[model samples]
Target: MTPANARLARLRGGIPAVEVGARGIESVARNAGCTRLRAIVISGLTPTEIIKHVFNAEPDIMSPFAMTLSQAYERRLLENGGASLLTAYREKGHLATSEVKISSVADHAPGGGVLARQRRELETQRLLDMKHAGNPLAPNLILNPRLPLALVGVTHAIELDYMVASDDARSYRVGVIKSYADRGGKTDKADIRAACREAAVGTLALRQHLESRGDDPDLAGDRIDMVLRAPGSFVPRLFASMRAESEMASLVRTLSTAPADLDEVEQLVPAGTSFADPRVINQIPNNYRSNCKEHCALWERCRAQALAAGQPIILGDAAAEQLAAAGSITRALDLLDGRGRPPDNRAEAALATELRAAALLLDRIANG
Candidate 1:
């Protein structure tokens, strides 16, 4: 590896696999099904000394803004007895805004470190226990409550923006605050989907935690609230409740089948291999797709590798599917130019015919 490549590899490998707090769970959920997850797992398992580098972390651009909006919304809910947010809730007549009491865990054990995290966990559990015991003082809305989760043998904690009590106080709902704007009942579908997935994971973690405590898991309902910015302003608005039962089930299935440790992945590399070495990274298999650019740090390397190998996937998924029979871009061009024979398969022959026709049309247009 060249000096520049080695430095880049070290920079990428230096990022902690699991960030502290809720961002950790969000990162894991976002990177699922991508090569980034594999890199994250490897980073976590590898010794830090092997991947040492002095680097300043970039400031998070979105989460802080979202958190600020959420905090402001929370304040609004507290003011005037949550009159502004009452209409956002689907339930009606069974409860009143004035009747709801809001509490926050944001200030409890603030800051990073093992001791602070332990304190936050203990405080969250204590509050949940109170709510379960039907304590009248238990607030209807719990903000920034940290819930524990275990994924692939690694323990993580997810801090939900809000855990609101049901009208009857028999259950709670998960809430996620996002900065994406919702205009005229419309928002980015991808953003909505991502938020829903995050909320589902948070709900699942809360449900599992309740179950572990011998409480009714149903206490954590499937309903999730997405707090999004209003159409024309930064003001937060609660969108309609989304049911995440299917999403939760899908994640549950994924978790059950995933490897429990790095043993399986570690076998792919030679003993004592350091991911800080660009050569070692190249040896690992990667499934490169256009979307991988959004989530994977290794996207550039993977795309270059795919291009070098003449893999059709570098052209995008739809194009790759269409050219699947050709197997490679070079072979596809060869077939189109009549320099290579099509395979005996009917699909390949049909594809070749279509490619040849397209090439002829392009040539005629160019000549004209």
Candidate 2:
């Protein structure tokens, strides 16, 4: 077989491995802060009605706006940020010997060949040498650098925006270029949180690389420098080394635990769970919420179900959790209007009493 065909074959062989490895971090994050939810997502059953088929839960939905908007936003951010970074680095007095050099990983895609291996090794060594030499511009604003890592029964080639030297000079931090404008030195909270999550993925990959090379992995923090636009302007602003140690640790643990969950969930999947029929897919149990509409493909159907059932999840997570004691809107309303009795449990009864009082207050105000 020709070299190209040989490369394609090798890539095909590693497809499952890549899925198990590369998607581990993302799957882990998707189910974060809730283990049951993790089980659903990691099983590849999330935002699907499969769970509903089994448990009579809501249909799965993905909000088109959330997914499309974010993808477009990130693409724009990275393109602009790359140019901005080169300029920013040069402005810091580091002269680019030539028009900013970027190591394009795609030229050698579907790796494992000797040339590909050498290219990666050379880039890795260059970064290391710069770090050892305390070169502030060691990573050189790499356009798309791939870091190879193996963890928790999976292996992934993690791509990063750029690997930059940290403030300490001896250590390095992942450089995550975001498009969010830093207004008054503050960006959107949700955007910052999402950026940090992506940064953690890069950091984990880097730390794994460092450990494999016999370097001190601890020196690498789950931190990233967010390069974004200045508040109300198009100029780049450098936000140095924002650390999210807790987020990083949580990510690692979640990914580490995901493989086992995936195994179990796959086992639970029925033999005839094909998507040939829309009704079959709708039978699958799904959890729906206001957030689901932003990212899930099945958001509309799931949302209709939530509205029909009057599930508090139609509001959002906080409201759903807050009203969980009532179980449904109708039950809560019944309690407030003195038409339905609260459960015999003390905590639930207390909640009912509070709702009743609030309802009475609202009634009095409305009448007045």
Candidate 3:
């Protein structure tokens, strides 16, 4: 076969990822099916989605140097340092404005190839059976310089959320972030307030998702109230920010009752910004995508620790973790510790359904 044909074969097959990135969402989708792909994307790295998006336009994304869709996203990500989407703008003194780069967008179509030539497959990949799907926007992402961070934003589409959450036939979207300071081996006041902010931010997000669908049929009697839990995400960042027990205690009042004004919540975000930016969700930094319960390289360690000691072992060497306070960090670790064990059988079975559907999608592609 010619080199181009050979390259196509390799791209569609399963392969290990290269670069700072640890894995690929496309391969996952290709192997498991679109539903599984979406769930993995939602539960895996944030850049994996972007990488998948980018490659959808340019299938031959690999370089002789070994730049997989995974690696490129990481390189672009770390270049921005620790800046979340909103901070990238504020740090540059452009709080109210920013641009979403286009070259950063995915070039490949939905089924591992260019879209214009093969449109039928894309429809199938998107229309798989779904319960409650969510569409996450990277803010004009497909439009120059891609946004630096994965800011949290809310979208109202049923397909994407199910895809992200393994299409469990459930409709709810949730996100969390926590920050703290590390003063030697202790947590301080700064750390406490930060942890408080993390909890508040997550709670507010849950509130938004719940309130947005208040009168909708999905919720009225059924629970448009789908579970919006992310204690693990919020608690860690808070522990990173608060270094002392007292500091953490001081923020208790605010945590108990989130203020009407967002300034209180702004205190939680490292960039000191609010959700005023229409693209707040899209602007959230995607750096932590892979670090969640599902895909972190440290999962095994945490699993052993949680099973043995009943807690999370979140002592990452990343600069982001070190910068946070001990209190916030510890709380997050505790929350993660709680999640180490697998979900209850019911949830697991739902997740299994998603994986099978994804595999089916891949089967369709392989046959074509």
Candidate 4:
């Protein structure tokens, strides 16, 4: 994948993996349904951590999200639709706006590199000044405003989807334009969640930019507005009430903390460690979930690992929670058969009792 795509993954999935994984580790002990030790081991590793380890192990090896042709087409369509929506906003004169469509191809090409970014930065500043001047028709809406930030020690020119000025021209909040339809202010949970995560990162980046410019980062609002089209139509709708403070706090924490001892891990891994062989890539462990297949290419491999381990989690979240006390498939079966090891605590004991009663009910039903 491109650097842009990799950064997107880090924001949407990698950062979240680290945040939730930390929580999973902390609460694993108290939760009887958790595979305490196993969860702890896995939770300690983030997607970025695994990625860094493998990348350092072999510079030539890159683990990018693999997408099918159809998936790619769908993404392009959505992006084009978002672009069209932005153009529509300008055409309809919703607000005075300055839009700079930074072409990835032109930006990365020779001679276009620094100049292209410099131009965007200048334009972004100009728009900000206009907004601050309280010019009613000032470029209150800025599309693709570049905000720079460091991710995993690499400096990146991050861009917000849209930076909108408040009517008072005293503050701004980031807007994420998503193709997901807002049907009476309702949409797919997963779609909204992903969009929110993306917007949170943009918000954080914008705040960072504000701080660098000697402005109060608080001027960057804790809320993110998701601009979407109505279902089955090109008409745009703005979901402006989505608050992201809680999620943004988690993201900000994990992103700001840097890990130690990566150098040691890199030294230990053998040279020429590349993704050339499927077997080699398989050797690197990853936390697999049912949702992994949505954005991860190695979904099938990870799914196989879960299957081989007989992790009930492979079925669903509910199954994982229900079987948590059982810990493993073998243990669950043993409990049902009244041949499992003695429960270490009251919770497991109670779960065992329930399992035995269910087993008896199943036996009776089978006999009848």
- The estimated TM-scores of all candidates read 0.76, 0.67, 0.19, 0.64
List where candidate 1 sits over 4 angstroms from the true fold.
1-17, 20-32, 39-95, 216-219, 256-260, 340-344, 364-368
Q: Write the per-residue lDDT of candidate 4 for residues 175-290, one digit (tens) a residue.
A: 77665557754667766766676777777666776777788888777887777766666466666647988667656654433221233223322365423223444554455666
lDDT of 3: 0.28
lDDT of 1 by residue, 110-191 (tens): 7878688778778878887878878777766776778787665555576776777743576567777776677754666756
| Per-residue accuracy of model 3 over 1-368 as CA lDDT, tens digit each | 55533332233232222211112321221222222222222222233333344223222233444334333333332234223432333443423344332111223332333343234223322321122234332221110111111112111111111101112223322112212223434645433333333332222323334454352422212111011112222111211111223322332332233221223323333353222221332333222222333333322322443344322223443523332332233433433334444434554444445445666798899998
Off by over 4 Å in 3: 1-185, 215-368
What candidate 2 gets wrong by more than 4 Å, as runs, is 1-83, 90-140, 148-152, 166-168, 231-234, 256-260, 272-289, 293-298, 337-342
Candidate 2 lDDT over 263-363, as tens digits, reads 44334334544332345344445567565443444567667877888999887787788788888888877766667564757766877888878778998
For every model shown, the clashing-pair count is: 0, 24, 66, 0
Query: How well does candidate 3 match the true structure, expressed as C-alpha RMSD?
Result: 25.9
Backbone clash total for model 2 is 24
On lDDT, the leading prediction is 1
Please give the CA lDDT of all the candidate structures: 0.64, 0.58, 0.28, 0.53
Error of 1 at 237 (Å): 1.6
